[model samples]
Each structure stands twice: as structure tokens, then as C-alpha cells.
Target: MFINYVKGLLIGSANIIPGVSGGTLALMLGIYHKIVYSSANLIRLKKVKEDTIFLTMLSLGILTSVTILAKIFKSYILDGSTRETYLNMLFIGLTTGIIFKLKQEIKTRNNNNNNSKKITKYFLFLIGFFTTLSLLLLRTYNISLDISEYQNKKSIKYHIVIATSGIIGGCAMILPGISGSLILLSIGTYKEIINIISQLNIIPCTIFGISTIIGTGITILIIEKTINKHFAKFLYLSIGLILGSILQMLFTITKLNVKPTLTLKISSGILFITGIYINRILESTKK
Candidate 1:
């Protein structure tokens, strides 16, 4: 039970990163399905021992990370445009690693079957591409809610709006390929929550946090059920989405500084290559 909670905490922290998802972390940790099942089966707790304990610890970790890191993350988003670009690079590296792993797994599993269809692979790739593209384009809208100003004028209407945004954000978080922060940005609540956190305003932040918990629970329930029903197609789509997200992030902040330094280029290549190498290492360990 303690192990489950601890792991959940770590996963929660990973999910809070702009380009990552709790689901992705859960998948990496090999608990994706189990976590999903646990959440979706919340009502059937009578048959599941210690489910609440696991969930509580996990939730605590997530809460701590979001409150603490939200401000830091927001700083990157708002301050000196370079932050998002750097973040995008890191996520691109991470997603590239995941995509390589996914491809290797698919190949290994299908190697013995000559009758296996190849078109399905391409089909899944396209799904991921389009989904990722949609998120990238969304950045242009500048749509976001600025909730931090509520400290001076806390109203029921503000709470309702924040809660609604949280629900939508929660849905984006559950989907393997979608960026939750980006989704929040689209709905207009991301900036508000960031402001609230940045200013260290507790009341409104707490309200928004509670709403996120409720929203996350409900959203995960539905997504998990759907993934379980269509595992392969969903997996392929997820890979595509992750890949697309990486590309989108790359393009969103694409900039060519005057006279590209050889050092910068070398360092980036190393980071990307190192990321690829890490993927290979993780894969070999799985065997």
C-alpha cells in the first residue's frame, strides 16, 4: 500500500510537467492500467482492499507538486518566452524516447506473425499526428482564464468558472497524448490559476485545487474505460499524439538565433541523442 501511494506521488509530479501526463508516467511505471482500473472502479471499493489509502497518498503528492510547481511552471510560461521553448525541447526528447520504445514493442510482438497487417501502424501514426497538430494550433488562440484576481473580489461566479476549467483541464490530463496545460490555456483558466499561484493567494488556489481533484477523478474514469475497450487503436493513437505533441512543441517555439553557435547545436544533439540512448537502455532492461 505504501509503495502504491509513493509511486502514485511520483507519477503525479511527472504529470504536472507541461508536456507530460500522469497517464504517461503511469504507463512508464507499468501501472497505467492498474491505476486506471483503481480510479474507475472507485464505486466498487468493497471488492478492492486499500484502494482509498493508495488514492489519498497519490492525491497528496499531486496537490503538493501542482501548488509548488505551478508557480515555477507559470514563470516559465510567462517570463521571457524562452522557457516554453526549453520545455518543449525537453518534452520532445522525452516523447522521442517513448515513441522509439513503442515502435520496438510493436515490432517485437508482431515479428512472429507474417499475416500481421502493416497499414494499421500507419493509421495509428496519422491519428497521433492530427491530434498533436490540433494542440499546437490551439496555442495561437491565446485563450486562457486569469483566476488569480479573485482574491480581491471572490464571487460564486468565479468559482464556477474555475471549476469548469478544472474539469476540462482534468479531461486533457487523462488523455495520453493531450497536454493538460494546453487544454487549460484553450479554455482560459490556465493563466488565472497561474496568477493565483504566483501571488501566493491561498483561498482561490485551494478552491481551484479541490475542483481539479473532482474533475480529474471523473475524467480518468471515462478515459480508462475507453482505453480498456480499444487497447491497440488507443495505444497507437497515443503514440501518435505524443509524437505530434513533441513536434508541435518544437514548432511552437521555433526560433533561429543569429549565427547558431556550434556549441549549442552540439549540446542539443547530445541531449537528443542521449535521450534516444536512454530509451534503448530502458528497453533492454525490460527484456
Candidate 2:
């Protein structure tokens, strides 16, 4: 239970980071399946006792982190353009590490039908590649649709918007390399959602939170079962998605033109090496 809470806290915090995914962290920590399966069975309260316990702990951690960290995220970390640049660089390293790790996983797995596996891999690779390319383009296209502003005008309308964002975020949370915060940002609710949480606006938060829980649970449940049944295909697609996102994020980060100071360059180098070291440590720990 304590372990699950720790895992959730790590993943929760990761999810809030602009370019990171809680699901990606969960996968790195070797708890993705457990977390997703538990979420699927969370509300049942009948036969799945262990899943319930783990999910309860995990939920507590995620909720606690969101309520507290969202404020810090909005106020300090992402407050300025300068800071956002440095942060994005850090996330680029994180995403790079994820791609490396996923690639390692794919290499370690042996599929009996090599040709079929290769074809499926190529198909999924294109899907992930094109999806990522489209999102990268959308960032600059900037056709402003501020759904949250509409919600603020009418009390009843707010519920509908929050619910819709929750459903989207919930599903995005499970997708490899896709950031829920980025999805919210693209939708123009990133600031509004954070502000609503920071203000302790209970009704809207509660409604969104519950809806997210339900949607996330169902989405992860289906994903968990499907991945378990088709490990090779899922692994290939996830790896491709991670690879594509890392490429896109690198492009985005480099274009920001935040010239790294000598100190910043040294720090980034340290972080990159540290990321590799951490992966090795995790691998040995599992051994």
C-alpha cells in the first residue's frame, strides 16, 4: 500500500510536468499494469481486494499531489518564459530517457513471427509518427478556442466543459508519451483548471475529479487487458509513440532559443548522464 502511494505520487507529479506522462513513469517503475488493472477494478469493491487497496492509496496520492502541486506548478515553475525553457529542457532529457528505456524493452522481447511483427511495428510507427507531427503543427497553428471562458460565463455550462476535459485528460493519461497537461493547454483550460484548483473551487473540481476517475479507470482497464493480451503490438506502438514524441519535443525545445549558459550546459550534461545512471540502477534493482 505504501509502495503504491509512492508510485502514485511520483506518477501524479510527473503528469503535472508539461512534457511528461504519469503513465510513462508508471511504466518505468514497473507498476503500469498493476495501477491500470487496479483502476479498472477500483469501484467494484467486491472480489478485487488488493486492487482496491492499491488503487485507494494511488488515488489518494494523485489527488493530494494535484491539489498541492498545481499551485506550485502555475506560480513558480511555469511562471516565466525563462523558467519554462529550462524546464522544457529537463523534460526533453526525461523523454529521451523514456525512449531509450522503451527501446531496450523491445530489444529484450522475442517474437516468433519476425515478418508479421515487423509489419505491425511499421504500421504503428507511422500512426504514432503522424499523430505526433499533427500535434507539433497544432502548437503553432493557434486557433484559439477557449472552452473554459465559456464555462465561466454560465454555471451549468462549466460542468459540461469540465466533464469533457476530464474525459479527454483521463484517456490521454493512459496514452504513452502524451501529456494530459499539454492536451489541456492545447484546449486552453490549462490555466483555468489550475486556477480553479488553487482557489479550492469545490463543485467544479469535484465534478471533474470524479468524472476523471471514472473515465480514467475504464480507459486504463481496457488498455491494461488489451496490452496483456497483445504485448508485442502494444510494446511496439508505445515505443514508436515515445520515439516520435521525443523527436517532437526536441524540436520544440531547441526552437525556443534559450541559449544555455555554461553552468546550465554543465547541469544539463549532468542530468543526461544521471538519467542513464538511473535507468541502469532501476534495471539492476529489478534483477
The lDDT for every candidate, in the order shown, is 0.64, 0.71
Top of the candidates by TM-score = 2
**Decoy 1 TM-score against native:** 0.78
Q: CA shift at 184, candidate 1, in angstroms? A: 1.3
Worst-scoring 10-residue span by lDDT in model 2: 144-153
Q: Which ten residues in a row have the lowest lDDT in candidate 1?
A: 251-260
How does model 1 fare in lDDT?
Answer: 0.64
lDDT (Cα, 0-100) at 38 in candidate 1? 72
Tens-place lDDT per residue, model 1, 1-287, is 55666666655555555555566655554566766677777755543656666667777776666667777766555343644445555556656777766666666655433334456656877977787677666655554455555554468888788777667777667666677766676566666767776687787777767777677788777767667665655667778887766765565546323234686556566666775675566556656
Provide the TM-score for each candidate, comma-separated: 0.78, 0.89
